[model samples]
Target: MTTAAMPATPADPGAAEAADVTGRLDALDDMLRLGGGRLDPRLLDEAGALLDRAGERLRLSGEHTVVTLAGGTGSGKSTLFNAICGLELSPTGLRRPMTSKAHACVWGLDGAGPLLDWLDVDKRHRYARASALDTARSDTSLQGLVLLDLPDHDSIRAEHRAEADRFVTIADLLVWVVDPQKYADAALHRDYIVPFARYAGVTLIVLNQVDRLQPEEVDDCVADLRRLLQAEGLADPRIVTASAASPDGVLGFREVLVDTVAARRARAQRITTDLDRLAERFAGQSGADEPPAGVPAPARAALVEELTDAAGAPAVAEAMESAYELRAADFVGWPVASLADRLRSDPLRRMRLGELREELRNAFTGPVGAQQGDVDNALAAVAETVTGTLPPPWARAVRAAARRHAGELPEDLGEALKDALPTFNQVPRWWWLIKTWQYFLVLATALCVLWIGLLVAYGVFGAGGDGANGLIGDAGLIPYVAVLAVCTLGMGYLTNLACRNMVALQSANHGERMERHMLDSIERVAEAKVLKPIADELAVYAQFRKDAAALRG
Candidate 1:
């Protein structure tokens, strides 16, 4: 038995529709890659395989729509197949199953070989109406159609059934041939018809052995079959009653086939149905009706605060303040007082601020044990806040993304702190002027004291008391020395007071600067370690949702 290929017809009406479906499939492929492991593996694989087949069909034989005749044992599928082609192509007998392998009939041989190759049908024949009888022939309507007679779906041999099922998946249209006894078979309805509910638009049901039934009972049987099909979720399915043995009985079925081929919409409808099925399977993973709003600001601030605490930023800032105050005091305080300050340890050195700065510049190296717990807790809190309202799969994905760099966060934060620490050892130019003025004051005080000592020595050690007393009283030097010494000491004291006040002001300014730097560092760490990952996951989710909606459409 041989079958013919569809004839070349006018421009394909399904080109635009096919393009739309192809674009949607491409979007779905991108979404699957973006979603990573978040989507169900099995569903993804099934969708991927179906898409490949659809793409291959569209590329190889888009101009031809392939329809298959599938049915159970003793259903006369082959007989109907031959009757439709108007030739003795497929053999028929009382055998349990007539056709074991699929046979193809193409109306127009152009561009049909590749499609037949994809369908794995080797036996093929071409049939074209002669130009002389074109006006009388109705078969011209089925110009670009490829008709196949598949092995019985209920064949006793497992391979025959498998072959039939394989062809059913690839065919653009399916025509189920049922005899009177098996029109409502439980296995057929439950396993085949129910599962293909999405393909109802491209499916046709035929009662192939209706000639055996009483004339009065035909209508009742047809009505009952319609109800059963509708119950199986096929609404208003096309049902035709025919007998391949009677030429007139098969005419109605042939007319329907002709119309289907003429419309050229079956291929597009089949692909659209497949896409819808995939969309439905993945709908559960897309949470809520719409994409979520961005993460809250307060939550972000809180996360930064937590990270700062974890990184010991406050401790470092306080140390900066103390170090600045100590250095300032040593620079401007009275010589005597500053000596005591210098004897104590420098706060910045004790904290190793200089070494930390060098380390930050060269490479990140610092211990973060003090605030590691705080950092982890902060990260967890931020992840929870971002994913709290998401569906389970998406929520988990977001949480995982947040912790993608968990092990590196502590080290990164420590390096950030090192960078934030302020330099306190720098000397200002004003200190030099202040030091010179203090030196002059010391000199004046020392000169005054030395002059007073010489006067006292002259008074105590003079050869005669009368002379010394006379000279001292004559010069009035006693009060002169006393006033000079008092004035110089008072001036030096005032100078020390003024310098102390200036140093205090400078320390306050430096403290504020250091605080700002520390906060900025904390914000950066929060952005890199916690916030970026959450954003990435949300991006993938958004794309997934968009693609799913397109496929649904």
Candidate 2:
């Protein structure tokens, strides 16, 4: 037997709607976090209030929908409210102004007490539609409805108007009751309709007390009101005409309410509409999205170069080269010349580079102050490169990130240079070998000079004596001794020439190596302190844009 799989259970729209609301809230929070310092403060506060209001509303029963009746004096708002509830719930009179406190008539009051409390309606003013005494179940279609009768919107008392405005904002559905006489009042259109154009989907424009108008006049008035609403940017506004004094006074409104309550979307729709409006406001402040490409290679290199110069890298490297040459001179110079070389100071030592750590710290504190301008320029250049395509606010954020840790920049560069410079204490084997050869040549030259001096003395003091005869055989050898002394000195001179050539080659290599090390060290510092921060700011902007887009959606 073939068994058919049951159709997948349809998704619970309520759960999905709740999840969507949650996602939007999360996105709004992210936008706030990323944009707190960059965006307008007042707008952020409004967004925060919306978040709190939405959360509080969600915490209450999503099953119930709050519908508010708002209208100016003599609009028969309370009469229409009583008619909808099928009872005299809210007081109606010919007085100039009506109730200041709102009255709530709730249907299916199970799980609705907390919601009513949240609305802050006085308990004495609250009424229930679905009681045990009602056996006919006539209000079944209006179950889960929290109907509120608010004070007249144009009440003379400021507190009453304020109270009406507060409830109007949080209500899921708004039934704006207007009699034909005051339907075109500027206060109604300006303060309520024009400002709430975005909420037209949940709004109802009821032309109440229309019994006074002829049927043709009612059509014309409704048509004129519709034109006014459309001009005010409300799209396809829903308009119903009724007379609270008639037997079937609010039948049309009841039908709309039943459909609205059954759909169970008014609450979600209300908050979502609020979020949509807020998201659009936020979007106005944010510009086009520019993906973060990080710091450009040229910018990075330029920053390193600037910092390397500020840290005195070139000077130190040159000093290292000169110091090598000086040491070579001391090791390979002729004995007397080597003593003179010792009298000259070592180049690196003259710069106080032997105590690298302390010297650099002091230099950065003092001499390095002159290079602060260069450092600032380099940072600005990098920030400009990174933020060139960003919006003004985000660009400012990126620039601020670049300079946030700038005070530490000079010291950081100094430390990098300190670690890069080589210690000159290590002597190459070739230097030692060349020094030993020079020592041997010096000893030979000294012996040859001594031989020539002795020969000269004997010839002068004992020319005809036995010593002279003994020395006579060596008389011709004096010239040879003299030549030998001259040859030994020339050989010593050649050794000195070779040592100079070798020191020159090694010194050049040493300088180049030192410069390379300095560059590498500077690159690392630039990446850690400057480039990384810029990239982080860009990332924040990118993420914020994504979240804000979600909110807009």
Candidate 3:
């Protein structure tokens, strides 16, 4: 059958009562799902979370409602769900599924629990508490009113089962529908009713569509049904007659529901009585003295930090900052035997330079950050932190310089991280190291080029051997690199130089940005993002504890 909402009324007090009762049912359902009675702190924390979100809403809006209907399919539950709410319905649509899917949630008004989110839903309808019965418009019901509707309880989907099971468990006032045909369905009694018998007092069992029998013999069938419930160990279960299609037995059934003489005695209390019980339950949960059933503050805080850090967002964001300073430097060539090797170490020089800039920024920011200045030094320090010790900076510097000069960032990256991770304790190291290394290398190479020119002017320029000395001094290109792809390599080297100078300045300004990002993420993880839910839970527990204490007093 297609679902349609209740028609608006002049002053619908019926729905106001609905909100209060439905909200309480929602609260109980939330508690059950969150494992409120268990030691699993995560579930309890979630429970505490639920309490905080709905507290104000509970207090202000739906505090005067009664019975809430929920059950499974083939249980004749939809016919029963509608009978309880007393909402009229049309025949099923042409292509309705044998098992309904969309939940037909009928509350006297807006419900109490975070039912929407748990449903993974975003409801666009507006539902608010009507201040008075006369003011109650469409769905809003008054105290002692009942809400009815079908749930897609028997759907193949797990989500549907969860939704139905959850709603059934939480309702302060609930009805379980069973037909004569499938009255003994194990899923109904075992999956829903039996385990929740602790809540049987608020329950109603309806033998719906009983009008199919001889009208005069309805009483005998209802009697046999009551005996079955008694066999099920339900206390004085209230059995009602309902027919969605016929509409004859429903009015009588509705009166019994609102009058509250069902299976349990609690339903008899007016909607206000139920609301008071709820306020009592939640108020206790909210108090400072309440048991710490919700999330521990520290754990929640930590989780938030972890999530933020996962993005590496802080460092990326902070690098947009700037700082600058200048200093003089010198370069010199080594022995001819080592000449090729030394020139090849051009990348090492850039690495060292980048390391320097990063350290400077760290110094500027404060304690605990990425330090720039000599990759040898910082790498050693970080390595020590990661592995407890590493080679000294000077030795590392020498080794770096000793590496094949042909090394380029993209080529060496894989190996560098391999070394950095296990030995140096670097996680996510390659990109940063490669970037820093490139910037530092180009700057050093440029400076080295300038040094060769100075040396030439002093002695090597005018005194040439077979034009080789003059060639080396004048062009200032490494002899071998110049021989093959010199122009391409030269352009790379020159562009690298320009880019390095700019990056060097940029790094100087923003070197600690990464470290800052990591630190701030940790702090927020400890504080706001993580702590918010936990603190909220603690607050609920406190309020609950206080209320419990007051009740005890």
Please list the Cα RMSD from the true structure of every candidate, rounded to 1 decimal place: 5.3, 4.7, 21.7
| Candidate 3, superposed: residue stretches over 4 Å from native | 1-43, 46-57, 63-68, 80-148, 215-217, 260-553
Tens-place lDDT per residue, model 2, 1-553, is: 1134224423333567777988999899888888898778899899988988898998898778999999999898899888878888888898757788999998888889999898899999999987442345344378788999999899999999999999999999998999999999999999999999989989999999888988889899999999999999889999988887787766787778878886788888898899989988887656685666588788888878877777778987887787777667767766646555558856765344345434433443432431567778889988988776787888888999999878878777877777776555677888888788888877887887776666666665544455454444355668887788788778878888887997899899988998999889888988888899899888888898889888987
Give the count of colliding residue pairs in each prediction: 14, 0, 51
Candidate 2 deviant stretches above 4 angstroms: 1-13, 131-140, 338-370, 458-477
Which candidate has the highest lDDT of all? 2
Model 2, residue 247: C-alpha shift (Å): 2.1
Off by over 4 Å in 1: 1-10, 123-136, 339-370, 443-451, 462-498
Encode model 1's per-residue lDDT on 141-233: one tens digit a residue: 667778888888878999999999998888889999998888999889988999997788889999988889999889999999999999989
Clashing pairs in 2: none
lDDT on C-alpha atoms for all candidate structures: 0.76, 0.82, 0.44
**For model 3, where is the 10-residue window of minimal lDDT?**
325-334
Cα lDDT tens digits, model 3, 1-553, are 1134324322433355445455554554544443343224553555454454444324433333334455545555555554443443312332332333323332334443444333322243213323353242222223334343434466666766665665553444676767766666777777666655445556778777676778776787888777766777677887777776665667656666445422223422233343344444444233232234333445344433333343333443343222121211111111221345557777765665567546433432322222123222322332222111211321232233222121221122222212221111222333355445544555555555555554465335445544444435554444433343334335445544554565565555453554454445444433432234334434443443443333222
Q: How do these models rank on TM-score, best leading?
A: 2, 1, 3
In order of appearance, the predictions have TM-scores of 0.85, 0.89, 0.36
- What is the alpha-carbon lDDT of model 2 when measured against the actual structure? 0.82
